[model samples]
Structure formats: C-alpha cells, structure tokens
Target: MLGAMSSIKVQCVIKEKNEIGESPVWEEKDSSLVYVDITGQKVSRWSSLTGQLDSIATENLVGSVVPRKGGGYVIAEGTRFSFVDWVKRSFSTVAHLDKEKPNTRFNDGKVDPAGRFFAGTMGLELRPAVVERKQGSLYSLHPDHSVVHHFDQVDISNGLDWSLDHRVFYYIDSLAYKVEAFDYNIQTGGLSNRRVVYKVEEDDGIPDGMCIDAEGKLWVACYNGGRVLRIDPQTGTQLQKVKLPVQKTTSCCFGGKDYSDLYVTSAYKGMDENALPKEPEAGCIFKVTGLGVKGIPPYSYTG
Candidate 1:
C-alpha cells in the first residue's frame, strides 16, 4: 500500500464521448494527441494548436495507435497488426496474431525505445451469455516483420513502458493488479528476470494504461477508480494521485510543447444508467497541467 498525494485539477479537452477510450499517444511531429475508441471503432486526432478534432472510422475494433517513422500509424485491430494511412483513410494488414482464437482482441500497446511495436490481446467474448477466458498474450513485432511471443495467459494485458535507461521494462496485467518489472535488453528485445514491482490494492482500482515521466516515475490510470496515480517504481511506492471527474480512467500519456501536459482517456463502456448521471463526463479526454514535470517523447515505429 502507498500513501496518497494531494489531488490535482484536470480539465476536459475533448467532449466527444467514446465508448471505450484507450491508447492516448502524443504526436510530437504535429503537436497533436492521437487515441483510439475500441468499441466505437475509430481513431481520433485532437490538435492542440488549432483545437481541431478529426476521426477515421475503422471496420474493426481498433486497440492502439502509434506514429510511423515515415508517415501514417501502426494500429492493432482485432488480431491483426496493420498500418493506416489516416490522411487517405486506407489501411493494410501487417500480421494476424492468434488467429485461431477469434474471441481475443488486441488491447493496449506501444512502441519500445528500439522502435519495435509491442501489443497484447485479451479474451473478449462479445456474444451474450459468453464467459470471458484468460487466454491473452503479449507480443513484440520487430521492424523486420518478425513477431516474438513475450508472455502468455495474460488476463488483461494493459499498460507498458521502459525505464529511462532502457534497462528495465514495466508492464501491467489489469486482472493481476500489479506492476511487474523485467530486465530488458534493448538490443535484442529480450525481457527477463520478471518480478512484481508495484501492487494496487483492491480499493485503489485496477491499473490500466501507464507512462513514464522524465523523472522515471510511473504514472498509471486506475480503471473504475477515477484517478491517475504516480508511483516510484524503484521503491514501489505511490508518490501522488490525480483525481478525475469520471470513473473509468482508461489510459494516459504526456504531450504538449514541453511534454508537460498529461493527456488522459476514459471509458463509459460498462457503466450502468444510474452510474452515467453521476459521471456525466465519463468518456471525455482530459488533460492535467502544472505538474511541473515532463515526459519522454514516445518512439515511433520504424517499420
């Protein structure tokens, strides 16, 4: 258990609600924030400079969105990894993962510092009266079009990031309620020596998406907890907490000119009618400023 820090104020930047908002990424090149709405089946861009919001509809449930080195975006749709030319609304499949299990869908993902795209899947039974299974797995897609299985039996593979030095890798399995660390090899894309680095108590909410700050602190979104927490990975202690007006805080990332604005995404996918009125702002994108800290720019996929 970790002590709570003072609450910080957050403001809604985008009011266009999403069914399940996740994967908030800052496109430094265009000074915009890009994210996906899984259930809504859309990828959105919110420009900070012009206050413009644009969206491209997808035929499948889009999991994550990250910038490509040259242009376009690498996205995880269902079990397929694909590249999307947002400007033209065109997409091409890169690879199909876990094709045998149609019940699984790609979830949270990001590119490593070495420019490899890593995404994971979770058992998502969409049919009524179907029970979900723990058949999720994490994988890394190299620039050369190679896929490597990193972990298996993940119930809900979510947040992922590496330390500033790139020697330590941190991951979150929402169902496990713990942040796990691994010894990372930047050159080979190898993760070993896995161990629990931080645990979220049941009351604090389940951990989902995460981002590392310039100071090396891990900021995690607490799903159904209505807050984003900052923790010291080295000591596994909670350093601070930023309360949000909504309950389902899905993911977060740092953006803005100096990378000082923390952009957060939320969800209203599972909220009941009674819960909706209490959290009217549920599904809106949020931003927290004045943290007096910065985050490292996310690496774009070279492939």
Candidate 2:
C-alpha cells in the first residue's frame, strides 16, 4: 500500500535556460544537481557550494544521462550512444543510434538497481520539430556495451523507471494517455506481463517522466497537465496530485541523503510564450521536500 499525498509545501530552487530540462539527477558525491537540456544540447552541473553553474556540450541533442560508476556519464544522443568524461571533456561513442539509418533519438532513462542501464528511444526530426508516434523502441544497455531492444514500435518512448525493489518497471509513452507497468526481472534484464496502470486525462496532459517512492508509490509528471500525479502500481489508483506552475513539466527525481527532496524539471520552449506567466515557473526547477521516498542507488557500470 502506498501513502497519501501530504499537504506539504514545495518550492522551485533553481532557474536556468532549460528549454527542455529533461532529466534532473542528484550527484550523491558532491551533492550538486546535474540535468540536461534536450534542445539546447547542454549538460549542466549545478553546485550549491559556490552557487556556480557549469555546463558542457553533450555533443548532440542529449535526452537523458546518468553518472557512470567509473567516471563521467553515459549519454544518449541523437540516435547515438556514448560516454562523456566531464574531467577530460571528451566523448566516446559506445554505440551508434542507427548503424542502419538514423530514425530515433534517446529520451528519459535511468540505471536499475541491478546495475544495468535502461533507456527508450523516440522518433526525431529537426527543423520545426516533427515528432512521430510509434517510431520508437525500448532498450537495455549492459556494461559490456551490449544493447538489446526489449520491444519495438514505441510511441514517443519518454520515461523509463524501475521499482525500488527492482521487481516492477514503469514507463511512459508520451502522446499516449497510458502509463504502463511490467513485471521486471533484474537478474535477466527482462520485462513481462505488461499492463496499463494509468490512462492520464488527455485534456490535462501526456505522461512524460515517472519515479517510484520507498513505499512503492508512482509519481509522474504530466507534461501538459500542470501537475504531477501520485499513483499506485498494483491497483492503478490515483493517490494525489502535486500542482506545478507550469504546463510542460518534463521529469522528476529524488535526491538528498534522506531521499526527502524531489527535484523536477520543466519545459518552456514548446509552449506559446504568450502564455508564459500562465505558468510563471515554466522553465524553472522545483523542489518538494518532506515528501519523497528513497530511490535505489544508480547502477555503477563496472564493465
């Protein structure tokens, strides 16, 4: 059973030119916040220490990233997979997005507890931004650089997340109203028994990114919904809603030692600027304290 939403208050902590700050992560070592701008092709590392903002090229339209156990990060580019060493400022191509022909780009993804990185792809077209539906696939990247597609024909494969127990997997198909769940097998990196956990209100928004709390409750950012929803995976129950001052909330992650701080990202580029103040915090980062559940430690890539 999941817990109910508390009437606790949360606030936006940082503001930057996100355009589309897709994935916000907490670097456990330095206690800084690192996130990526998909359109900007910028990877930003924010330090609370000196109140300084550092950024570097992700080399391409980077969708999501995670700190590598060895060093630097594993980045998903425009159909290309690579590694980025922040210290040396170098990029390594581990895999190509299209050894055949570029058709998709990486989106939201994360490291599962069992030490494997899971990510999904989205159909991408530059200039005027033509996004196609069902032109995507879900993949698992092993430490050895071996890639496997668990499924294909994904409609805007947006967010890939796992349960704290590493037994359940939740994913979002942006533009599709449904947020789906699957029986996750950590040992084999396999998913089975897929089901729709929540069919979001189309009028409200499309499901973008998601996170699971310590108690197994699911939290999802409704990209165009103006709020984040708390859900129960087993019963498909809506437990609560955390309202945001933005319409294009991209994603959220739990950081801080206690896992009590919720960091969220938003998008300002997609919406009509004429309606900016309608969401005063459109491109800002938000924080929800005293309301988060601990997440599993990011998988370290030892291979």
Candidate 3:
C-alpha cells in the first residue's frame, strides 16, 4: 500500500476557472506564474505579489508557454509553434508540425536547461463519446528555429524536466502511467537510453505535469486523482502526496518569490454533469504551501 503522507494546506487561488488548465510556468523576471487553458484557448498570467491576473486570447488550442530570453513567449498552439508578444498581443509562427494530422495537437512542454524548447503532441478527440487514437510525437525546437522529431507513437505526452546535474531527462506519457528517464546531452539536447524511473498504478491516477526541485526531487500532478505527489526519482519511492479538493489536476510548478509555493492547475474538460457538483473548484488554480522546498528557475528559450 502507498503510505499516506502528512496533509498540506491547499486553497483555490484563482476562481475564474478554466476548461483544461495546464502548463504552469514560473517567471522569475516578473515573479509571476503563466499557464495555459488548452480547451479555452487562452494564456493566463497571475502575479503572486499583487494578486493581479491577466490573460491573452490565442488563435487555437494552446498547449504550453515558455519564457523567451528576448522578452516574449514561445507557445505551442494547435500544431504550430509561435512567438507571442504578450505586450502587443501579437503572434508569429515559428514552426508547424504534423500538418497532415489535424487530429493531433501539441500538449505539454518545457524548456531544457540548455535553452531549447521541447513539446509533445497527442491525439485530439473533441467528441467525449469517442476515443482518440494514439498517434502523437515529441519534438524539439532549436535556437536556429529548426525542429527535430525526437520520439513518435506518444499518447498524451505530458510533464518534462531535467535533473539538477543536467544529465538525466524525465518525461511522462499519461496513458502509460509511467515516468521515463533518459540520458541527456546538455550541449546538444539529445536523449537516449530510456528507462522507467517511476510507475503509477491504476489507483494512483495518471501522471500529468511535473517539475524538479532544487534538491533533485520530482513533484508530479495526478490527473483525475485530485492530488500531487512528490517522488524520489532515484528510488522510485513516494516521498509525499498532497490531496486537493478537486479531480482533474493537470499540472504543477514551484513559484512564489522563494520558489516554495507549489501552484497547481486543474481541468473541467471531461467531467460529466454528475461530477461537476462534487468538484466545484475543478477548473481553478490551486496553491500548495508549506512544503519547505525550493525549485530552480525555469530556463528561458534563448532562441
């Protein structure tokens, strides 16, 4: 049995709601948190210091957002990667992938320690009554605006992070219910020697988004599980688990001035009418405090 860890205090920080909230990224430059509402087609920014909230409408389903070193955002919207001037609310295309596969769209993504942007796609099934086929892939956007296809046959690709040493890369394919590790080349953004570092049983819920802390531990969000887990990647042991008030927990990242706060985003996308009442805060952004841990600042996309 998975042991129950101590409970931590969690609260709904943003009550505006999102259909499929994901990809929470902490911006050290503004001391704010930026995230995406995939189903709603918007990117939101929340200030921790002033409680100010802002959002930008996008043309398509936005999967993720990463800070640019040149003062903008690199976003994966639909099948295309683009640069967004948050100040001007303008977007310019960087690259488009899988144009033929309109059924596939980009999902979770993050920037590597070396400043390359990596994102993965998944089969998009709009009809809740029908099941989507697994026909997705992972790609890396280079500094020169080139893209490299890394892996194919991915299903609901989500959650990515690198180790503190920059030698190990971690990823999640939600349908597989496992976290995979790779031998990483920090200089070239290459991955190899894939292995499973952690696995989630059916009862534990599927892993969604994830972030690594300064101490080299992983904090993973549990979609449909109403919780976030802190795991020791080396031992594949559950170090801690935080229970939330709602299911459909999508993604999480360490934010706040000291990077001690764990900000989580949840979804209301697939919930039925019966499930909606029970989870009133389903689509809200949650904050988990008192973890006493710190995280490294997310690297910006230098390109």
Give the TM-score of each candidate.
0.95, 0.91, 0.95
lDDT of 2 by residue, 134-247 (tens): 788888778888887788878677766777677888888887778888999888889999988878887757788888777888788888777788888778888778888777
Worst lDDT window (10 residues) for model 1?
1-10
For residues 1-303, could you state the per-residue lDDT of candidate 1 as single tens digits?
A: 222123344899999999989999998878999999998999999998898999999879888998899899999889888998987999998887744278888889999999999998888845311227578889888898778889788888899999999999999989899999999999999999999999998787989999999999999999889999999999999988888999899999999988988999998887789999998899999999877779999999998
Tens-place lDDT per residue, model 3, 1-303, is 222224456989988899989999999877888999997999999987888999999999999999999998999989999999998989999988844277888889999988999999988855521236567788999989989899888878899999999999999988898999999999899999999999987676889999999999999999888889989899999888888999889899998878988999999988899999999999999999777788888999999
What would the C-alpha RMSD of candidate 2 be, to one decimal place? Answer: 2.6
Rank the models by TM-score, top first.
3, 1, 2
Any idea what lDDT model 3 has? Answer: 0.89
C-alpha local distance difference test of each model: 0.89, 0.78, 0.89
Worst 10-residue lDDT window, candidate 3: 1-10
Error of 2 at 163 (Å): 1.9
- Stronger candidate by TM-score (2 vs 3): 3
Candidate 3 lDDT at 203 equals 76
Cα lDDT, model 3, residue 106 = 89
Stretches of candidate 1 above 4 Å error? 1-7, 98-100, 125-131
